[model samples]
Target: MTVHDIRAALAADKATVGTWLQLPSPDVAELMARAGYDWVAVDMEHGSFGRTGLPDIFRAIECGGAAPFARLPVAAKTTVKAALEAGAQGLIFPMIETREQLNQAISWAVYPGHDDGRAPDEPLRENRGVGYCRANVFGKDFDAYMTRRAPELFLVAQIEHIRAVENLDAILSHPRLDAIMVGPYDLSGSMGLTAQFDHPDFKAAMERIHAACKRHKPLMGLHIVQPDPEELRRQIAAGSRFIAYGIDSVFLWRGAERPR
Candidate 1:
């Protein structure tokens, strides 16, 4: 599905489901993708996989007709460039608490003159290194991809701290921001309430963030890390569009039970 499909689902109060991948194996990636996820995000930050085999993993996912996404550990330009080079169609940037961080992360994804008017605040042009890579079929489609299609990649800022909740408006206002996913554990941890999703403070923060997303156009996302069917339904009813349901490791230990 396209971003428009996600928006349509959100407009209808439906959820667009995706999953997470932490293992490096293309076998694992293909399996999850074939399992019917709209997208599968490789947890680069926490996944045991290194950068060398990202393209293979992504290819496997694509073969199953799913978009391959990356959950970046940090917003480093090199990391952003690497993931894009490896054919990541989407990116979930972690621990973003300020507009500057989010802006820089977006900048790294877009090439020069293709900023799409997103970095007006930046004193410099986009620093993304244009190169022949798997994303462009290794220069086969480089010209067209670099000039226009590259900007079509999905970019998400992960809201994982109380500070991000507080600054939602500024962060969400970015024209280049495609989506925002809530890292509930990190968000609660920042509030001195690690993993305490039931805490009133955490609940309040979620409400604020959700409201902020509604006020803006970015698709609201949530990580249902533990794969609770009831919780997933509840969150979808409450308007989460980009939903990450199961981690690859969790599916391994718990067995692959398709979410309802």
Candidate 2:
């Protein structure tokens, strides 16, 4: 079955929003999908997810008509390959701090031999070897699958640390970098504000990251907690193109708050 490309859907202004699945449960993922999200993210970075849990969560996400994305604990080639083989359609790499990190993230996500040293957005010089399974399984018919899935899978990088902010330009300018996401809490802590998004330090960092995204013209995103619609609208007006509304657990917790 051809999976819906969540990243492509969003790029087309198709209202693609996702909630994280902190636990590996197909039932929960199915319910969440029915509730109206376009994608489901499996949070391996902060959850109990391991190699054992990957396939289960990914399958659940797939069963829900929602694309599955893995937020890796770190941007390691082996880790990325593992999740992709498990059937994740996208990857969100955390704490990306340099251009080299972006390149590595792309290298890990894409097939090998694909790096013809050409510009990122440009056409490939050579069809890279299928060094991964997501490619092998779905992209087995390379030409057809590449036409459908190559641009569909997202290779996202998080901008949350002070060093990342300082290196934002070089990082964003890298051809392989697809999107830039903000980790407000981590970014606040990195800026010494420690969860204080209202602080000038935190605000400045966000602005810097936002401006960098605008300059680079890649997708810009944020994972906000209980985000006010107006505030979200303001950011969109200000330049953010991608936004994750909330976490899976938080959405569940809020729904449970209704008086019975």
Candidate 3:
């Protein structure tokens, strides 16, 4: 489906399940996309793929008919712009703690030219002049893409750090933020309860996130490291619209060990 379809689903509060692709191979990306994921995120932060490697993987994912997303290492302007230019229909920005940080990310993601006259705190309105990258079909479909597809580009703010959790309300208030994903491990570490998913502190943090997302407009998302169908269902029932279920490596390892 197109980015427009994904955006519509999120707007309708529909459950969209996706997988994490960290193997840095277009083949793996294509394989995962073909497996019927609603979306696939190219994990650049923790994965080995650099800026140069993203386009091929994105192409492969699109070829297999799944929307491609990029999980950025940093919320820098250059990183966000490059990823979008390379054909990421959506972006997962990690470690965003402040409203300013998220605002900047949205500005870089949506604005193609400098100073569209938006307020400093507001993201630019136009999605033109992104300069003929893979996203616009290498300039072949630039106008059509800007006017049609670019508006549907998804933007997700990752609530990982404790500070982000504390500032959840303000962060979620950003009108351009399309979704919010919680990083359980990082949040646990931030709370001084590293890897303790069952700890009260961790569970409470998750609860706070759920409440905040329900209070806001953006879709709630969770990254599940293991393929637990029951837990996935529970999260969705709890209002997690975007569910990122497991990484490529973990799935591969589990499949390999299943016969043993």
Candidate 4:
């Protein structure tokens, strides 16, 4: 399982760019992958794709040489397991507001015995191990997959709620958490200031998040919906290593409208 080098890039404080796939078409996914994004996330929360359709899209993205990631609808164990089994090299768990939630999300994303020397039949059996799936090439690649690929799986917590901002320190301190993705719209809405990116309180929230990221050293992620070069550069300058640049639908819409 060849994966993107996002983990090392983020660890070394280098910028990594990715795009969101909101459309359900594998062709669109492949196109985005081939455009040279470090990662391509399938938006299960807002996209038309569901569990049944995820694996194929993941395959398509991998075919184009980009790591496949999934933005889960919620931080649920079943959803995380399903996405991992479908070949998502990483996950973006939405609406995280507490340390416990982040911890649970990490637990679900990782195989228990892989980190700790616990038996599969231990007291927490069901919650610990992942069954043979596409992630392990359906058993053929189990050894290499566990030893090489699993360690690089990225686990991101989306900080969308005001409470998550307030609890940022504890959430960032989670040992297994790899990155923090900010959902500006949802964060603003949580603060009763929808779409007010320039509002003082919203700016303050972002400041706190950046400070926490600096303190904890996990990758700080921001979704630059417009994909302007200057804005991308600005975000990278501001310590955001995980940059998600726009969605598939919007990119297509804009490209279609451009004069030939």
User: Which structure among the candidates has the greatest lDDT?
Assistant: 1
Q: Which ten residues in a row have the lowest lDDT in candidate 4?
A: 116-125
lDDT of 3 by residue, 107-153 (tens): 77775653322456564443433577888888899888787767777
Q: Estimate each model's TM-score.
A: 0.92, 0.82, 0.92, 0.92
Show pairs that collide, candidate 1: none
Tell me the spans in candidate 2 whose CA falls farther than 4 Å from its real position. Answer: 1-15, 115-151, 257-260
What is the total number of backbone clashes in candidate 1?
0
In candidate 1, what are the lDDT values of residues 19-68, reduced to their tens digit? Answer: 99998999999999999888899999999867889999999998877888
What lDDT score goes with residue 243 in model 1?
Answer: 93
Q: How do the residues 73-103 of candidate 4 rate in per-residue lDDT, one tens digit apiece?
A: 8888788888999999988999999977776
Q: What is the lDDT, from 0 to 100, of the residue 77 in candidate 3?
A: 73
lDDT of 1: 0.86
Candidate 4: where is the Cα deviation over 4 Å? 1-4, 116-128, 258-260
Please identify model 1 stretches exceeding 4 Å from their true place: 1-14, 116-122, 256-260
For model 3 the local lDDT of residue 106 reads 74
